[model samples]
Target chain A: MTQTNQPEINVQEKRPLDTGTAESTSSEPRFSPQVDIWENDRGLTVVADMPGVNADGLSIDLNDNVLTIHGRIEAQNPGKKVLTQEFEVGDYYRQFKLSEDIDKEAIAATIKDGVLAVSLPKMAPAQPRKITVVQA
Target chain B: MAFLPFFGRNFSGSFWELEKMRSHMDHVYNALADGFNQIRRNYTGVFPLVNISEDEDNLFLTAELPGLTADRLEISIKGETLTLKGAKTQDNAGDETLNYHRRERQAGSFSRSLTLPVKVKSEDVGAVFKNGILTVTLPKATEARAHQITVQAQ
Candidate 1:
């Protein structure tokens, strides 16, 4: 395999900070994201739209092909003490069952601007190859 | 609005500030934006506009529009302010069981404003709302668009 940089995860900062908008109801799970998956030549790209998550509070883990994402958002405290506030805070949880064809070791992830991207490279069998046969 | 993940820093305050009642008025401003409660670390998309990016000629603005129809979704520019307003609501629409479980998606009236970084032909703005996405195309003004005028020897 040719040498290239393994995908690294970095939390890109938000801009203008005004797009900093998010709301959660009392009973519903707060700050959950909806994920969209797209397959490409090299691997599968998962795009998850999760607004209000920040760099310091995110956790992504893979165990036995089960991918889990967890985060925590501090609840808003009412009645004074706050000046101007911007940024969404919430505890988050999401999990996915990854395909066996994926090369989990080569998986790369990045989270920025409340979007999470995961690239899952496929294994040898997952790629197409020409077959060789001899007549018996 | 108090962004949920951003309310932690605002958690500290004194009784005098609250007792004096100045803070009560400030809550209205936050309430208008829809306060963000319970903030945690999040995994969001990160696309950077760096010097090396080649596609600066085309501006991509993807607005999250869940239910608003094409008729309701409006994009207009007055002076320098670009305003987008729409509402996505269903009548008596959600299942009670689902709402009881976990409802994260925000479905209601939404109005967003964006100030363009560059001047564009306001009259030429084209907008399309499809599949819960609002894509607007604003042709760059003559001076704002890119060009290469080479100088020749006289």
Candidate 2:
């Protein structure tokens, strides 16, 4: 087994499956993770199920309303010699297109025990005013 | 509000039209099959996939997927719809296919599903895949998050 001297930057480019940006984006069969969303009066909260992933190997970034999450999970039996491998070992990839209503400046993320949580604050109306009407 | 579009719904206004408007949260859950032990829900324009006694508030979900990359996982949520889709490539181990005695690893494509409990922006979803495990972050709508309220006396 190999050990790292420092914490992983946890970026999308670190994945081995990132090549052929065209192949993954193409209409090819693939695997995806599960997600759960919750909304409040203030912002949005998202919970994603990512087993085998830890905090040091996770990353969260956004570009032009495109949120990207990338992480590396510890191999189940890295050093142990394997006779057979039923589970696939590769990078996880997914994409999402956001709307204009989200407050991009205040999105937060955390990974705990293989589960990732993200907080996205919603933008408020641009102007506020009180309406007054004269009684006729 | 009548003139406004239903977010995911296209001009056709058909239920299927929203398929193109999937968010990362929705994509992650939709990719999963029922597999005889799965529960999913869509509420407040969000998707939440839950099972019996699985309400740990911070439950964990790991899938058995091989021959895939981190960039392949698709997680998204549009309004209340969640979609998860990915494809496991064919195993290309050096000379392993020819000398294999028995093959039992499931291959090809995989998808998971889970409706949301609150509304979310598809662009805000986050996911990562590594060492055969894929992880994503599903953010709840600020209004749907658990919070404390104060009482005001008039």
RMSD of each: 19.7, 27.7
CAPRI-style quality class for the chain A–B interface of candidate 2? incorrect
lDDT (C-alpha) at residue B125 in model 2: 61
User: How does each model score on TM-score?
Assistant: 0.37, 0.36
**Residue B125 of model 1: what lDDT?**
74
Residue-level lDDT tens digits of model 2 in B1-154: 4654655456546534455555654766666654322333222111112121112122223343333455665655667665656554333335322332223333344444555545544566666555345444455556654677788999
DockQ of model 1 vs. true complex: 0.03
**Once superposed on the true structure, which residue ranges of model 2 sit more than 4 Å away at CA?**
A1-21, A24-31, A75-77, A127-136, B1-154
Candidate 2: residue A91 lDDT (0-100): 38
lDDT of 2 by residue, A23-85 (tens): 665443233445555565676666554555667767778888888776555554333323222
User: What is residue B60's positional error in candidate 2, in angstroms?
Assistant: 21
**DockQ for all models:** 0.03, 0.02
lDDT of each: 0.52, 0.50
Q: Which candidate gets the maximum DockQ versus the true structure?
A: 1
